[model samples]
Target: MAKDAVLVLGATGRIGRLLQLCPPEGLALRLQARRAQAAAGKPDAGWRLFDPLEDPAALARAATGAAAVLCLAGPVPGRGAGEMADHIRLGEAAVRAGAGAGARVLLASSAAVYGAGSGLLAEDAPLHPASAYGAAKAEMEARAAALGAELGVPVCSLRIGNTAGFDAILGGWRPGFSLDRFADGATPRRSYIGARSLAQVLGALLQRPALPPALNVAQPGTVEMAALLQAAGLPFAARPAPGTAIPEVALDVSRLQALLPVPLAPADAAQLAAEWAGLEPQLRQEQSRR
Candidate 1:
């Protein structure tokens, strides 16, 4: 199979690291990071430093000859107006760079864009982002989509769900973990995807003849925090959930499923745990090898 080259911005992030450990098959990477120092002494690592804000042309040059440009650079967690504005600036840079290369552009958005919602939220669901983070992602999606339309490039926002190892409940687990138990005696439920699955989804999207403006990337259903803990053999104490707590934010991936021949993940607890445990440690092994 012929490999398609992809230029990945924010290559040093957590999700980026996961991608490094489990890249999609038949896809070559041109990695961009914040620091040149990180790429030093690694000839085969495919690492490069290109700041779109400083020199958009450098990004364009780097993205040339790629099938797609995947910009995972995102705002900080708080996602204040200034932070979101900065993120939008980066997103705009991505659009221009991809347009310069005549390649599709994929920007990383978050499920937080749906905010505190119960049941399955589809791509067409209206934005009701609760936090500054959610609002910031919403802004990025709108701006990038609008700009992509103007630029005549295929730009899509990936409304990605929680990855198994990247979620607060899993990654934040300590010796004594405590979770909020809502009045109905349930912990927060969320959609999640595995590291390898996410890579495949992105790869598949890049190869698709047509791309949707926005897509929800996740396993088929929702998983409770407690179920995740149980699957991982981690015990947690339950405290009453505050009024601010959201019960669920499940994504409707029917669209994603229809686009691909393979089935999306089934949202089983054991499999989520296995995927996280299996994929997260490989990063260290990969680093050691590199």
Candidate 2:
């Protein structure tokens, strides 16, 4: 099998780290981080200092000779106009770079683009973004798709689900964060994919000759918030907002399933909780430093 060189932007984030740790077989990686220091000691994989917004040439350079460009770059969480502008700029840079390189492009998007919904959300579902973050992602997807069409390059917007990771599970219990519930007192269910599964899906997508315009990436089943907390062995308190309806964001992953070599199982909340428990102390220590 030939090794396909893939350029990954925002290569220092949680998802990026997982990709590095468990990359797809026969895929060579070129990881671009904001700081050159972040790439230290990663000799097997190509590394470069890149700022998508400020260094457009660098972005193009990074994409050169790459089979695919995996864009994970975006503004840090903020609802301000400046943050939204930055998010849009980052997406534009990624699309232009990938198009210039004539490589396949995959933009990491969020399920929030589907807005508040109760049933299985498909890729073709109407986008009704409720938050600034979600709106930014929707804009990115639109722009990337248009660019791909104009440049004759394939682009895929992956509406990724909740990723099972330490911060995702434990952050709910952090102070000032409240777990949401429906007005009827039912915990909202959400589809999620483990880090390993996510890596596998990305690998398969990168290797494919043609790509779908959009695909919902998630596991087979959904998990409830209360069950997730219980599995983590944490005391739960309802912070139900009166008249606020929590939406169940379950994804229809049949399209992704058809592409994968094996079917993806629903995430094991109990097992994820157990893993989070083991890292609780470390997580807390890091939180304190922040």
Candidate 1 Cα errors over 4 Å, as ranges: 79-81, 284-290
TM-score to native of every candidate shown: 0.94, 0.88
How much RMSD separates candidate 1 from the native structure?
2.0
The per-model lDDT (C-alpha) reads: 0.84, 0.77
**Candidate 1 per-residue C-alpha lDDT over 65-179 given as tens digits, one digit per residue, 9 for 90 to 100:** 9889898887667646776777788888899888889999999999999987667899998899988888878888888888899999898889999888777888778988999
State model 1's lDDT: 0.84
Clashes of each: 0, 0
Runs in model 2 lying further than 4 Å from the true structure: 166-172, 175-178, 274-290
Evaluated with lDDT, which candidate comes out highest? 1
Best candidate per TM-score, number?
Answer: 1
